[model samples]
Target: MTELRISQKEFDLFRDFIYKEVGISLSDKKIGLVQSRLSKRLKALGLSSYDDYYYYIQDHKEEEIFHLISAISTNVTSFFREEPQWAYLRENINTIFASTRKIRIWSAACSSGEEPYSIAIFLKENLDHYKEYDIKILATDISKKVLEKAISGRYVAKDIAGLPKHILQRYFDIDKRDPQAPYAIKEDLKAQITFRMFNLVYDDFSIFKNRFDFIFCRNVMIYFDGSSQMKLVSNFHKILSENGLLFIGHSESLTRNNKEFKTVRPSIYERI
Candidate 1:
């Protein structure tokens, strides 16, 4: 096996392709990162170059594009991440449920199901007759690979380590059958969520006819350029129920000039 290099031509091609397809902006600095990250896939496919892998993904469309996303995007997430948002939710939860027992939430970038599962666990702890409440969570991600793992409701022990023992005991089942994947989210938690493959950048939003009370699109917009971010925020405003809340990454902010939503907390915006 000879040493293969990703030429500047190859870097420019993939950079544009990734941005156009997924709304993620890659800088010149990420050329090394892209080459290093995607090289493994090229090797696995027995391809000689990055150009070949790019075309291979283009040809496969549904399956390999997902693989591309899996390779390119960072799916760094943990249970109960961004503590302040959860605290704010705790303070306002009853108000969130005041008008009706029915609740619909979309974990817009639910990587590996941590955010959605955390939402379920939060509701279960706070609400009485929680199962009887008409609650449904639509968990979507661009990566089919992660969605499969999410739908399987399985996790390794390290992934669940941040979770409290009581919550873990109540919400997850120990997978005695597999030592590799020791923690599986129990049926009670699994039943509340529907996992789907969705591309936030290109997918049709009209496919969702129902309004959600809250949409957790956290940590994802940081990857998008400003124009894409504004467009996504505007679409979220159109689909939320009145006074619906949008939670973003702690480091991300809705532009100060934007009229669609107002800040409720740091990283929390309410549809106006």
Candidate 2:
């Protein structure tokens, strides 16, 4: 039988390895988390120790390293999380609604799909009168596995508990097949959002071919250290239009690092 627990030395090595590879800093407090998440990998590889697993990952090809990240990255998300942000968007819809009839939004670091679905529902509701607007949401994440689920546009019923009844009725249909499962988002909403597996640490934004008018980057930045946060915030500013808006998580602040954006509201910034 292989030993499941990773030694402290091994944990440090793996932590440094991930940071060097992906700019994610795994603190000492996360040793248990790393062990819990990666122990399954060890068991799958039939490796007895963390050292063996580490070497395997180093020599392994792209697919194996991707699997390693998929195992460790957090994918926590839900429908209509932080209600005020949605309210904020609705309140100012007319101001940003342009003549192009095209609404472009980026759900950066969208996990398991809830956030982008929520965005789609919002557009279908508020922009219904404006037939000309082509609503498009670009939802991206580092995990290919989660991207697969996001593209499927299905959700467990409990995931929509906090969603408004009208929005729920309009955008989602109950999946009768899974009486106990969450309702799946309707095809109309799914068609408006595109799911792509992307690593924020190492992607060139030029391929997207356009600057986003609004970006919902939300909770994902908290995982990185100050430097990583700055780098991402700067990149966001660079990719946004002159007056584009950036919405981050409530707990996150950009007080010191990147000041290219002016605070329009709490956790909301506009490019200066």
Candidate 3:
């Protein structure tokens, strides 16, 4: 088997394809990264060249697009990723929910279930009479692979090493059968969340009927260009309930020209 090398032209083809399909802007410096990641994919599909894989995806796009996105995108996430966001939520939970007992949250780009599960645990711990309210958490990602792991709600010991002991014991059922995946999220926590495959750039937003109270789209917009980011922000603004909060990645911010939201805190914005 010959070593597969992607030519500069082939790399540019992928760069344009990815940008048009998913709004992710891949720079010229990312040629090596793309080649390294997609090489295994090409091998798995028995394709010999980058051009072959590119054309292959064009014909089998519905399924292969997911694979392409998964190959290139990073899904690095953790429970309670941004501490200040949690603190802010804790401090303002009452005011945020003052008008209604029905709460809806969208964990946009929620990877491996940590973010949504953390929300459930946070509500259970902080909200007085947690069961009395109508709560639903919608967790979505572009990759089906990650969504499957998230739906299973299982985690290895090391993945959850930093969590508090009581929180772990109360929320996770110990799976003694599989030491590799010892911690499984109990039904109580899993019940509140629905994991789905979603592409923020290409998916139809009209499918959403209800407005969410909070939207967590952290760490994802950085991959997108300025136009894509603004489009996503607009979509978020439309779907969020009045005065609803949007939490973006620590490194991201809504541009100054944007007026649909006002900054409540660093990386936190409220729909006006």
Candidate 4:
């Protein structure tokens, strides 16, 4: 079998298709980029050419599109990966929770549920009145596979290393001797979050009837082009209530894209 040589034409087709579908941008020089990323799927499917694999995806809508997203997007996150943002939440939860009795928060592009679960634990600790409030966490991701794993709320020991010992013990069941299985999140923590499969590129937001208090859309925008970023920011602006906070990845910015939000600090924005 010949090593896969992703031709220039095939690369261009995929690059344009991904950008149009999900706002990702790939430069012309990224010829080997396509080969390296999509090579696994090609090998698995026993397809000789990138063109053949691309056509297979094109013929099948749901499966193909999702595979495209999985191939193109990066899902590198961990429990409280950026600790300072959680610290901000710790300092401000009282004020934020005080203003709203109904806490509706969204972890957009939430990869594998760790971030939202972390948020849930944070709320449980700080908000003594949490039981009284109508609180729900909506965690959505583009990858169906990751969403299922998230719904299971199971993680290896490494993923839970940063977690506080008490919260880990309280919120998770020990795996006994099975290192392979890891600890599973307790029913209460799992109950606090709801997982859904979502495609951020072209989905309608009208179904979300109520405005959210906080929207944590972090680390996913690095894939999108400038126009898609602007559109997503606009959508976020429309969905968040006045004075609602939007938390983005530390490397991302809404300052240039949307005027409705003013950056309070790094990675955190307040709706103006």
Candidate 5:
């Protein structure tokens, strides 16, 4: 059995470890949250204490990093989340689809597949020859667990409560045969996306030799400090094509001086 309480020394050790490994800076106020979140991990590993788990993680860094992020990071997302952004995208559909009939979008930190799947559905609904267009969505997250689920394209019916009824009818096929998944994304829609385990903080972005038309990196940067945020936004600016769009969370902003990307709308930036 493992200890439930996190000592101050243990808290500080794990806090810094998380920041260094995952780039998520935990505040003094989050000490309790950290303790609570990691307790489950501690019990699962059968470690004697937080310190033991920390050392275990260091030794098994490759395998344990995903579990660490899964325990603490907030991955709450759904289809068509933040309604304004979708409205804006649809309003500018002509300019967007015109940029390249062959569209490439990256749903960076796509939690469980809703955002990328939403992108797939939106394109199908809007584009007249979407089937002919070379549409590909690169959906990546640090957590392999979520990526597995995303690749499976399975969700409970409640996972899609926010989606429109027509969209539900058009894109999803209910699986009465399976006990686990009440609804599953159609195989063709799942094929439109390529999900992979990618660490935005730790992994190399240079492998992506191609520029993307749209990069939806929404709501995840709140965990990053300013310097980290600047580095990521600058990378986004570098990889995005001229006139390409970068959509961030409504609460987040690229407020740092002389940012290269031009602001198009709330939480939307363009590399113009």
Candidate 6:
């Protein structure tokens, strides 16, 4: 098998296409990264060149666009990637749940199942009389590939390695039969979440009829350019409940000029 190379023209075409379609700003340095990542897709499709794959995606936009985004997007996530946010949640659990027993949370850009599952676990552990409250967690991502895994609710040992023993025993079923995916999320916890495919940049936000109490768009906006980020933040503000909290990636922040939200904590914003 010969290594496929992407020309500068091909790279530029993909760069513009990806940004237009998904709001991901690819830097010049990402040419090598894009080439290496997308080459696997070309091989799978039996396409010989990056140009062929590019046009193929145009013709087959509905299905292949997901594949294109999946190929280029990095889905690095864990059960509890950020500790400060969780600690804050723990401290303010009562205040957050005071108004209503009904809780709506959107784990936007939820890579794999870890973040949503963690939310479920956290709520179950922290909330007294957990069964009395109505909890619905919407976990969505741009990649169908990750959604499939999330729906399965299965994980290998290393995937759940950071979880405490009691949490594992309480929420996960130890599957000795399947060594590959030794831990399976219990049906009760899995029932609380709904996984779907969503493109934050391109999708229609009008589809959401209900506002959310919490929106976790963590670590995802770094890929978008400034304008796209601002647009996304504004959309989040519009869809959030009156006192809703927005949690973003530690490395990301809202611009000072923006007035839709006020900084509640580091990387956390409250709807204003």
Best by lDDT: 6
> Which pairs, if any, clash in model 1?
none
Q: Tens digit of lDDT per residue, candidate 2, span 104-214?
A: 899998988998888877776776466678778999988777887888777776677777788878888876688655677788778888888776766776677788888
* Candidate numbers sorted by TM-score from highest down: 6, 1, 3, 5, 4, 2
Residue-level lDDT of model 3, residues 1-272, one tens digit each, is 54578899999999999998877999999998999999999999999899999999999998998899889999888888899999998998977776689999999999888989999899888886676799999999988888988999999977797999899889999876897799999997899999998888879899999999999999999999888888899999999999999999899999997899999999999999
Candidate 2 vs candidate 5, TM-score winner: 5
lDDT for each residue of candidate 1 in 8-36, tens digit (9 for 90 to 100): 99999899999988778988888887988
Ranking by lDDT: 6, 3, 1, 5, 4, 2
RMSD of each: 1.6, 2.3, 1.7, 1.8, 1.8, 1.4
Error of 5 at 219 (Å): 1.0
Task: Identify the runs in model 5 with alpha carbons over 4 angstroms from their true place.
Answer: 1-3
- Which pairs clash (backbone N, Cα, C closer than 3 Å) in model 2? 101-133, 156-182, 157-181, 157-182
Tell how far residue 247 is off in model 4, in angstroms.
0.2
Report the error of model 6 at residue 116, Å: 0.7
How far in Å is the alpha carbon of 219 misplaced in model 1? 0.8
Candidate 4 Cα misplacement greater than 4 A, ranges: 1-3
Candidate number with the higher lDDT (1 or 4): 1
What stretches of model 3 exceed 4 Å from their correct place? Answer: 1-3
- lDDT of each prediction vs. the true structure? 0.89, 0.82, 0.91, 0.83, 0.86, 0.92
Candidate 4, TM-score vs. the true structure? 0.93
TM-score of each: 0.95, 0.91, 0.94, 0.93, 0.94, 0.95
Q: Which candidate do you rate higher for TM-score, 4 or 6? A: 6
